[model samples]
Target: MEHQIDLTVEQDPSRSYRLLPEAPACGPRELTVTLRSSARDVVEIAMWSETGLLPQPRAASHHARLTIGADQIASLSARLISRWQRFVQFEPVSGSNRLREKKPYLHNANLTVRPQSELLAQVSELAREGAYLLGELLAGEERALVRFRGHLLNVLESEDLRIRFDSDLGVPWPMLAVGCERLLEGGRLTVDPFRLFLGHRHQVESTSGTYPDYWWVSDRHHAVGSANLDKDLKNVPLADDVLKLLNSRLKDLNVRHFSDKLLPDLAQPVLDEDVMYFFCHGSYEEHGGRTWHALRLSDELPIDAPLVDGYRKPHTDAAARRNSVALFHPLVVLNTCFAGAPATTGFTGLSAAFVRHGALGVLAPQIAMPQVFGAEFALRFLTCYLDEGLTAGHALLETVRWFATTYRNPLALTYGLVCGLDSRVVTSPQEGTTGS
Candidate 1:
């Protein structure tokens, strides 16, 4: 049996609705409900199977219910068409992982509905059913329908969603997706899958400054008995390769391949650098009962102290004081394991400390990252951003796409971007003039 109910209550701000229909007391019972709303305004709807009819005592048994809001339907349709467009674009191209050069599909769309907790929960459930349903919804084949997955819905907060495309949809097979809850209503929203690009053009315009230079800091050596040597011994060559690549492309680039150096000395050049790349070992250590994420430096010095100090006024000589002030905010890339994990205390970790100082953003791994994949990702990311003039976020995303497609490895998703989502770093003319 099918039932329709109007859930709009004058007192409630969300314009929510609820539907209840009668069912038999015996055997198995199946009921379907269809919700209707005006097309003028986008409405978000959520539904769940209730144990009993209205005006009756509620039963303990509950089942997953189909909730379809007007806005969700429209949004799903739009996203499907956009994905299809991207798939079509990649069909003709070979050996290129770049997204088609075109305007984003969600550039002008307005999202009216706020994703409440319940709605987010439903979306989480939808993602678990595999990508077939979402693909179908995106294809615009279903107007409104419900399916019974025959399991109790596990109520868990959605952290991330993974969608895998069937073979029928060629290439770019699986996607690791995240949802943005707050968007400008009656404002433009661009559909850049994965939110990969940082739009830092405004930051550049506001400061009236040219793009910053590059600084690559690498530590290939560790103490004789250091625990990190076993895990990170292979990353030394990778770091060297990265340094060479940057030197070849960037004009005002500085490379510091250090061993047995203090934190302040190693971090001095980083104060004025525009882009800081660290290729070393990282770990989370519990010291004095407090956890900290530290990058292992060549001098066997943990970077935790410098990060704790952050950017502070120098109390020493005139030269030290003058150099203490930063000229440009850097975008730091910590190409090491566990660099992205948050510390137990205030602004902890190498990545967070850089951001706390004056960095525009930090790209680090949330867990122990494979050295091979890390090297590949770092090389491609820097190439795209420095050579191709792609934003840091976009470059990271493109590199991840290439890595994922090439190796069929989803480990790229482990790398996280913290802050500086819209920052861009371009090569300056002065640096351009003095090419290698």
Candidate 2:
């Protein structure tokens, strides 16, 4: 009853995997919705479920074209995105930009407009509306969507559902709402839809497919790891806590990568790391005519998408020959602002750069997070993932639930998965045969 996947990949030589213990197969009802740009203006929605559902008792999948396009759907989210800036800043944030969040503790003496509360409702409402529109979009198609809605309704209160979108539309699927109210006309949800925010209530991840590659733990001994933390923030208490967490999980934390004392070493093609974590500033820059994201590991220069790709060029020959990715697939956690948002043309950003180079997946904030909350979120997420042994998707699910219900913070709702929805840390290979 192990849920671990066996994806074999050949290295220049070899690498370590993980040990799998027996576990149960029963889990939350899950669905993967993939949206792709078909004609620049037009888009397609492909829905499928691996678990049973109503309208149909069997698992199912269906593909159909949407009359509405990505451009339109993406446009609806702009208000939420733009208005969101008032709530928090990047680098988690800096003193110059108000690093502390303003949303959680707002001046609501009159209760007229609470940014956090209102934003949550706005996002949740949009999510629900999107679901209803889907039913309308597939008006004449097979019951694929019909069954899809049925499954969504089934998980409304359970709040333990798993929904993943393999998309390029840039519509934040995690923020999209789903409910029975609109679909049923007068059926008000027993629970508030804002509480049903997909990112808050369920385990949701947005993914972008990569070039063909199989899974392989990047570490030679499953003990080596790196943390590309910014030098300036290294002394913060939470930053210390993070280093301690990594120290415990990894066999040998690469001290040089801590602040990359050399900084330029970041561009060196890496093949030995099991996990690459970044706790630094994330910013957007205009390059040529396109918007690209960059990461600051030191005061010298920024590490942008192209520079990230440069690291992998050295291994191009090997990857091409093996029909596999050149870089060893390490799990990447980007606790930086907008690290989760990908360009609609396809994923193009700091996070995507790592994903493109073969990181197991990237976990990042879709928007700028408050520094304090950002640190707390990283602590909890990494704990659930590294210590508790949950897949990245489920870990984020539990993490959001904890923050929303217990801590009452909504920023965690913005974390997105750029791939590896089902990726978990590989402890070692299963008992017997060589992981060949």
Give one digit per residue, the lDDT tens place, for model 2 in 1-436. 8798999876644445432343224354367677788676677666657665323434345555666666666665544454445444312234587655444433211112334445445434544654554434344444654554454456544567677777765666565555535433354334544465667777776666564355553233234577877777676447778778888887767754433453444455446666677888877777566676776766657776777667665565466676655545667888877777644232266666777666767888777655666777888888887777688888888887787666555567778877666666644333123554
What stretches of model 1 exceed 4 Å from their correct place? 1-238, 259-262, 265-270, 305-325, 343-347, 428-436
lDDT of 1: 0.41
lDDT values of the candidates?
Answer: 0.41, 0.61
Against the true structure, whose TM-score is highest? 2
Clashes of each: 10, 9
Assess the local accuracy of residue 402 in candidate 1 as a C-alpha lDDT between 0 and 100.
Answer: 63
Instruction: Give the residue spans of candidate 2 off by over 4 A.
Output: 1-13, 17-29, 54-60, 87-158, 180-194, 217-222, 235-237, 256-270, 287-289, 323-327, 343-347, 426-436
- Writing each residue's lDDT as its tens digit, candidate 1 over 22-131 gives 32122211211222343524232222324332122143232222344444544443353334333222222225765443322112111113223322232233222224
